[model samples]
Target: MSTKPQVSVAIQWATEADHPPFSELSNAQIRRWVRACFADSADITIRMVGETEGRQLNNDFRGKDYATNVLTFPMEMPSLGADSGLPTFMADIVLCTAVVDKEAKEQGKKPLDHFAHLVVHGCLHAQGYVHELESQASLMENKEIEILKRFRISNPYVLEGTK
Candidate 1:
């Protein structure tokens, strides 16, 4: 029996305005970006919500006033050895599409490419990647770049030239 971790993704979008290119981007595409940075057996939720819900979640959890592009809520639960031999749950990745679009334009990146970057970033956070320190930030950024490359997307930081 294979012991590879199962990758499961549940995606939700808010209304018509925040609709993502679900058909243009397949679950495999998003999953590949995530799996490249995380263990293959991870379970993730990628929710695309509007400003209101995004703002509420951000404020409630992070005490931020406005909606951010992506928010990660990790399960952080210990595992119970099961027949599947994989953790039952991982974390949730919430994305504000409106913010993503705006940031993409501001950062001068294609919407699809920016969306992929955020998905990769959010999934990494779900898998316990942090950017609180310079070292950690560098590591996370490197991982995001590697994953995005697999999808033919350029380095997000390079395009935005933040570094």
Candidate 2:
């Protein structure tokens, strides 16, 4: 029997460009990030889309005009009054494939590595990691570094200063 939590990953490409196996890697990355943060059970969804859809989502929800790397929509925590048998529903993470690939090339990083980092980032966001403040940003970055280290990836911050 499988012990992994039920996770739904949907890929939606608004453009004609074919991409890598993002869905499979995203699911594994999210599960790893979630396990690092929370011990309790979880259910989550991840979606990958093209620039047009990404821009639309960003404009509709975040009031941003351009497409972003990732966007996370977290679910409300279950209340005490709710059924105890219910599992934690974390959130949805929408990734922009165009943005991810472009940024990776510009940053001189492998596309797969960049995608893995962003997947971890989105998963962290679902687990309440935010960059609205310096402290939160530090916490999130540190966690990301730790998590990425296990996968043999270098620290993401090292590339930021040169770029």
Sliding window of 10 residues with minimal summed lDDT for model 1: 16-25
Per-residue lDDT of candidate 1, residues 36-154 (tens digit): 66655677878778889999999999999899999999997666656656655588888888888888888899988998999989988887789999999999999999888887999
Prediction 2 TM-score vs. true? 0.78
Per-prediction TM-score: 0.85, 0.78
Question: Cα deviation of 131 in candidate 2 (Å)?
Answer: 1.0
Q: Which candidate leads in TM-score?
A: 1
Q: What's model 1's lDDT at 71?
A: 95
Q: What is the C-alpha lDDT of each candidate?
A: 0.80, 0.73
* lDDT for each residue of candidate 2 in 37-56, tens digit (9 for 90 to 100): 44445566667778888899
